[model samples]
Target: MDLLSIKDPRFLKDMNIEQLEKLSEEVRQFLIEKLSVTGGHIGPNLGVVELTIALHKVFTSPRDKIIWDVGHQSYVHKILTGRACEFDTLRQYKGLCGFPKRNESEHDVWETGHSSTSLSAAMGMAISRDLKNEKSYVLPVIGDGALTGGMALEALNHIGHEKKDMIVILNDNEMSIAPNVGALHNVLGQLRTAGKYNWVKDELEYLLKKIPAVGGKLASTAERVKDSLKYLFVSGMFFEELGFTYLGPVDGHNYEDLLENLHYAKKTSGPVLLHVITKKGKGYHPAESDKTGTWHGTGPYKIETGDFVKPKQAPPAWSSLVSETVRKLAREDDRIVAITPAMPVGSKLEGFASEFPDRMFDVGIAEQHATTVAAGIATQNMKPFLAIYSTFLQRAYDQVVHDICRQNLNVFIGIDRAGLVGADGETHQGVFDIAFLRHLPNLVLMMPKDENEGQHMVNTAVNYDDGPIALRFPRGNGYGVKMDEKLIQIPIGTWEVLKEGTDAVILTFGTTIPMCMEAAELLEKQGVSVRVVNARFIKPMDVEMLKSIFAEGLPILTVEEACLQGGFGSGVLEHAEEMGVYGHPIRRMGIPDRFIEHGNVDQLLEEIDLTSKAISEKITAMVPKKKQQRA
Candidate 1:
């Protein structure tokens, strides 16, 4: 149980099933205790204890690559590979990443936070190994939910066609954050439950092989017979048809079965698919029963009762406001539908799903599918609101351009977490949405200044039947601003001046607006009058407002909780030039062109000079220097 003494030579090679099981329990207990304080992906780690052990025993890591799909389930893998002591720092700044990071450990071959990437990465690794004549195995552990993604399917098709020597362990626990959906899940379920047929078929083959003279010759034909029997009995010929030698439905928790199947998979020459079923929360009681995704990614909790150590006074989440507004709108109109790509709970669409079961859809980590499907629904005269995290939406950029924007479909994209989503870090930051979404034609992109504006935008997007519209909102709580009972649809492509000043104009949108407002008040007290404008719509820039500011010959400052490059500021710069306004000094304030690290959101903002005090001081310094130059 003392994992630090894993310097013991026999840790992997000599451990029996009993010893391994005990170690698994120890690992689970350790994870629970540590995660209870730190708060991380406790459910996923608790599920894969035996499987990680089996994998290490069967294949030499750092040589034989193992790509963990999504990588949240790699906590057990991390523990076994000499990171047990650092588990307490999970998800903290400069600490262990919640997901598998290649930089953190040699055992982690590919870094991943997004889903359905493991197979493709594994295939590339396998082909490269073959090319280099390096005789090492390439194994990718993917889940049933990830399999639902189109990219995973595309990889499967390619891997099947190539018939490369690789092992894909399909971890089927009937869930990925939520209960697994679609026909593929049902097909896998049928295969996993075909034990009766397997038993009978194995007995018959044993009997056939026992006869003396014909036994040797018949053994050759027996494989074909076995394949046929599998097709007749089990429905998992779906994997075999993809050129993989299917091997499981084996108990992922059982050490002997897992090790045996893994050994078998390692020895196979062509593509192999081992189906291992595991519970999402194998050891923890409350997590085991969690059908919702509460335990998927969580904060610190009480280990004994599995109760989250919720903040004493929690803030009203923006996602909840989006969901509540959308639900109310849908209740009023049958044509309004809600869609998400495997993030119903994260986006707070569970309430909508409950009220309008058929209308609410979870496309299962298939961002591309969700986007196109929403486009398709829009074509049929239905308003499909896609509520997806900004980072995940990056996976469907092509679809947004080709399927929706090209056709000018009226789809409402509720872009949640469209800013610096701290703690989750680079792979999960929502800062690139404005840059990417702005370039697409026939697409309207905007961010709300507060929950009231978010709700208003939702209403505006619902009524407008022109082109694809997107409304982005940041993570966590609203600004606690009271909502308007009646939806006030502001004119599209107009900016509202919150505070009128003469020195310089600060144009901002989304989360940065409040910060700008704070800066404005500070500047007013300092005798440097500043103009504050909430440029709600990123696209279709308010020309009148820009013209007014140019007429005053005031310095312009643009701020957003998005990327600095080609974002709202770029739009302002481009417009200023187009309007023939010369030598207007402009300062663009936002996330720099670099990957942000994990930390608390407020700390990260301060680090990036996005805090109110930082912005106020910067503006004060800039204006005074400009006035001196004029003098």
Candidate 2:
């Protein structure tokens, strides 16, 4: 079987168990080799090789609608569905997506990057099928960790009440990035140890039948004893009580077990929860031994030794710079506490967690709860640093508005990955945070130009008792700039002037500052004086600086690596309009009003014309020829 040349999973249905086993081995090898060169969610895909094969065997996709929650594990499915040839360019610029894409193949019925969404999507599909009188199955494969999400639980409750004919595959690998926490994870743990329901059912029936002919009282006692067996043997009674017919904690790697349970689930009338137990990073040793979740997703690595390919020496990661700064502040301030929604590893809060074990909270995947909890913590006169990714913060907008902003509590929010996050693409990009957070009352939003500024901002956020303040930082490493010996609290609404000029001003912050500087340098060679201002404070918009610039009558160019609509540029425009300085020639450069796709960061920046070349060209055109000649 040529893995690369393979097309469609229809061929899988005809293959015997031995052939499928061989194919699974080949797939593990293929993923190990390819993903080593082109990095991806290798651990997850490797874990699901057999389960994905079994799924394709048991149900007909496209017609049977297999919706994957947080579709990172769908690489196996993609390969089976004729995408094996696209492995070399995985997660590269304009290459194979890390997650499922509807445009990539018809077999991808639903697209997903976030967790705990598949159940709702599957329910909708099931209802539509019922309405149209269609005969295909609707199966949503969710993970044990995602089951704890508030949305997932709400959908579960609704699906159970509706009792729709859908099969829910609970892929229990005891982890979601980090080891799962909260009450739901404990329930799944108990279910893992509990004996199979079928075995207990048969034994109970046999025991009941052995009872001699007895009176009503004796028969009632026997019936009571039989019913008690359900509680003793079946740990999934929780889901059963919710109206879903629960199936076994089947071995996900075993082909026979997976197929049998899947077939049974397909035949069942109402909703069924088929619990399939799997091992995360089942085949690969380095990924398998990952206790801290470092191997969950990775960059290119050495195949022979599993050593990650290094860039010789690199600056400290932005996440580390922020989290470490928070940890440092937390040592002095007893009120400072850290919280993350099940991303301690990604957020780089392991050190903080270890130091302040009692104060650090990894509240699972419940962003809504995390937000409200921070608000609650803030109400008690304690500072809560809610560290979350920019994209995930979108889920807790209501909480941010109603609970945090309305009350005007002092909550520090560290918005990590607050710009175009390359590789992960549109669904995971952090471009929308500024747009969403800037308009909220009693909230101050800012971004830092470098690691040193980031530290000061973190200090500023933790020490501020005024209202809720957020610091947005981009993905990957910082610029390795020199740090000051003592921390200083930066004044709110203050913007820094990095370069002095007379002809034009380029106002930007964070990752876009370097580009602005480079563009200004290029413009200097052509005799154009371009001023670069780090517009760190997004909301308050350095009004004094704006007035001075407007009085100087310098042409302005606003550059940001965020959405232009209702973003920092929009804020600048609003300020100008209010100040009656609308005559100044102003141009905004940023991500246009479109969802950016997955690609290299530099490539994506170039695509949107946010490069130094584009900025220099725009600024050169804006300034007058006489001004350049005078310089």
Candidate 3:
């Protein structure tokens, strides 16, 4: 079958089992080929080929809804929903989104980028359907990893009690980003080997009903006694206790099993948990064998060898540098412990975990719980290093303010991917941490200018016991600067001048530091002597430096690779206002008040005018003709 010719999944209903099996293979090859050129969530999408096809075949979409959790694995759904033509432009600027977009297609009724949200959204939709007297299935396909989230569990409890007519598809692939970790994962493990509990129930009830007189009542009594059988054979009864009718450990890839289970779920009343077993990265050999999550998401790779494409030479990754430094420090300090919310691979904490196994804790997919756990550990006078992505950290905002900041506990937060993360788009961008975290009392926020300073800042954060301090680092590799043999702690609330000047000063940090330097050099050739200051500490502004620059009567320009409102630039502006240093011109340049989409970092930066040329132009306008003559 020509997969591109598939405009919608309506044709799937007409195909037999053999044709469906063949179509699945074609879809896999299509994904394996297209995703090689335009990188994406290939492993996830590859795993769900048959399952997605079977779903569209069983249910009527755009009316009978299917809400995907995280929506990363919706690539197969996209192909079946008349989106094959947009494959070339996947994850590019103004192109196909990596996650579900409501406007993209009518089939995409719900949009999701974060996990554990589908169940709650499903509940909302189910309730709306009930109130309107509508007849449609509300199926939320959530993974086992997502099921461990607090929100998912909360939704499960409510869903069971309400006894709403909804089918919850539990896609148990045994992984979420990294290998799933928790007690919940262990329970699912039991269900995988618990051969067809529903079949046992049906056979036992049939045999009992065949007995002549009083057999019907006897069979009904045996049905109640089946709870003991559930406890023995499988833990899926765990779902039964929560008010759901547990279905099966069906083979997700098998057309017969998936179709049968899905058909059963549609007819059942109340909430049903149809547990379907799938293999992540099911088709391609290299992705299938990837145990370390290397193939979960990827750049372009050679099809034959499966080797990822790369630059000739690259600097050390920021994640590796930070994690390795933590490993080195943990060698001496017993109180120093590392924690991540199930990002051991992405945060490069495997080395740290290997070195100090006892001190490492990975609280899976629970950012809120992880933050409070760090605060609890801090109460015992232990130094807890919480390594979390900036975008995910938003989920723990309340914990940050209420628990960590309020008590002034010594929690060290390594805000990884602290700037504009490319390709993942607005849902996963790390551009809002400073805006949200800066307002909280008793919190110190700082970003490093380069790799060398980044290491020092990490050292500074670990040793600082005054209160909660955070070190922000950008995504991707460092600047490849030479490192110091000894790790030294930088003084708190201090700023350094990179280039001396008589005209305007450019205040910036982290990813934008190099760009500001280039802008300064460009202005120098054009006779404007610009000063570049690496204002690393965001919360505690460099008061002395601000006073000196204000006294010098130099115009100020603040630049950041973050949101413009309530960000690092906002901190600078607030300081100027409080100090009554108002005569000089102050201009702020950063990401505008909107969400940035998927693309390369350079193109996204260029689109927002956060480049050297834009900075040069802004600074040039600030400095006058007479100031140039004086310099």
lDDT for position 157 in model 2 = 97
**Which 10-residue window of candidate 1 scores lowest in summed lDDT?**
3-12
What lDDT score belongs to each candidate, Candidate 1 first?
A: 0.86, 0.92, 0.91
Task: Give the residue spans of candidate 1 off by over 4 A.
Answer: 4-10, 196-224, 624-631
Q: Which segments of candidate 3 are over 4 A away from where they belong?
A: 212-221, 628-631
Q: Which ten-residue region of model 2 has the weakest summed lDDT?
A: 227-236
Supply the TM-score for candidate 1: 0.95
Q: Taking the tens digit of each residue's C-alpha lDDT, what string does model 3 give over 331-356?
A: 88899999999899999999999888
Backbone collision count in every prediction?
Answer: 0, 0, 0
lDDT for each residue of candidate 1 in 495-606, tens digit (9 for 90 to 100): 8988998888899988888889999988777778888999998998898878988888888888888889999999999998899977877888999889888878888887
Model 2 pairs whose backbones collide: none
In model 1, how large is the Cα lDDT of residue 397? 95
In model 1, state the lDDT of residue 106.
74
